[model samples]
Target: MAEPLEIGSLQIRNVSKIFGTFKAVSDVSLNVQKGEFLTLLGPSGSGKTTLLMMLAGFLDVSEGDIALDGASIAGVPAEKRNFGMVFQGYALFPHMNVRDNIGYALSVRNRAVAEIEACVDEMLDLVQLQQFADRKPGQLSGGQQQRVALARALCFAPPVLLLDEPLGALDKKLRVEVQEQLKVIHRRIGTTFIYVTHDQEEALSMSDRIVIMRDGAIEQVGTPKELYERPKNKFTASFLGKSNFIHHNDKVYALRPEKIDLIVGVDHQDARMNGTVSSITYFGSMQRVIVDTKEGQKIEIDIDVWRNANEVKLGDAVDLLWADEAAVELQMG
Candidate 1:
């Protein structure tokens, strides 16, 4: 078992970052619980990285304070804050072997030789990299180098770990494998994890809670299911997953493609609309059906591959039905 590290809550109080007249992050306040896996998710230029840099003490806050366990750490230097960071590029020294790379943090702090060795061993085991301990970084693959970076960051047993798209460098298959290992490592060590990613699928799959940012402000924050099923605004609805917006009674409502069903005959459904099938695209297990409705809206529906063009032809009139509860009312400004 690895040594248990102290973890605590982090509070960001009305934080903002400014580069000249433009606000990179605007009046953001959030609370992160101890040992929780919180993700900051957004598209490019959404200020997620700026916010993370402020939290890491690498960038000064333009307004408000950052507190760790009720004490302010905004004025502290990045190195003195006792936090670990892993970047997307896997910033490992090329000359150092795996064991030396993992032990560098401890050595910098002047820890005893025996203590550093023990900690390096524990970290190598934690990341399943013991066999590659003697190999230099140049000899390892991308995935292996990333694992080494993670082990190096965690070997010091920091209270919090900040990852800036650490898995973005790997291929799809290796990325998925590393993602599973990351979850396992987090569960085993119970450290507070703050991850930043633009990939919606990754955020949905890995985060305990997700904060979505847009134009330097938070659009919404919730669990994956909450964000997917009930979005507070149209941007949140569309960004988190596929959504079809319907204007009803001068109000905008969002419905997911999977929630809307296609009807051939008069079947019981809460709400129904008539439209012509504009297009059909095939996926392995599912098919995407696009329909042009009489209401001047193009609706997209996802159905099982078992029900395809054999039953519904292009330009054929069909009924799109869904439950009233399936439509989520949105507050669009």
Candidate 2:
């Protein structure tokens, strides 16, 4: 078993990547602990990929330096950086067998044949693809090919692993399966994983910490629960998860649909927003009720079937109230 990481530090200072006139990444600085699973999450054109590329030494910083374990690696080349990369597509050679593909890096470095064989087998075992050692990329399933790509990346035992939406091409069910596999591999190997993805659910499920970016800047960085329970702003709240933005005076409160529980309360004790249930949508395990309140506020509430069966009806007058603590504080920009 791998020992707990004595996590070296990663620091970036004033890193900017400007493409022509537009700023792809602008003066971004961030620190990540070694062996920490940190994900750079954002929508397209949010500079998350540019930041990852810079970290991998693929693109020039265009401004600042990046340090690993107190040493600057700014002048490093992509090959010399020793960072394993799993790109959006599984870039495996169609003609190469699984073992050969896994051992390709070791072979390029002129490692001994026996050593290369051992490393390849170990990586194959690591990804649970030992049985298909002789299979080529085309002969393997999509998930299998993905595992082979992961094994190839991990075979070299690099200090850092960079994933660029590695599972984006797979179907939803396969994506979930791969997510579990990747998390387990990270735990087993104890390597630093810097995952980049636009999928909020993916980031929330797999990462220890998520950096939410927008327009080439860091919007917020926190744990999944932190971002979900107490977001820093309206954008962070809305981006991280589902939010019901309630405009209250100068500040807007973000009340999560799951958090608005149904309850009976007196006029003074209960804060009620009188509304008519305009429509309802059946969403398998739960139901979504659209309620239009007196103050022209449309509140969308989700309730589990077992809990709120026939409790509220369409065009029926209902009182909607959320706990004061349940409404998280956020600023709407």
lDDT of each: 0.90, 0.86
**Candidate 1: how many backbone clashes?**
0
Tell me the tens digit of each residue's lDDT in model 2 across 175-203.
99999999999988888899999999999
Candidate 2 whole-model C-alpha lDDT, 0 to 1: 0.86
Off by over 4 Å in 2: 1-8, 263-269
How do all models score by TM-score? 0.96, 0.95
Which number leads on lDDT? 1
> Could you give me the TM-score of model 2 versus the true structure?
0.95
Kindly report the root-mean-square deviation of model 1 from the true structure over all alpha carbons.
Answer: 1.7
Against the true structure, whose TM-score is highest? 1
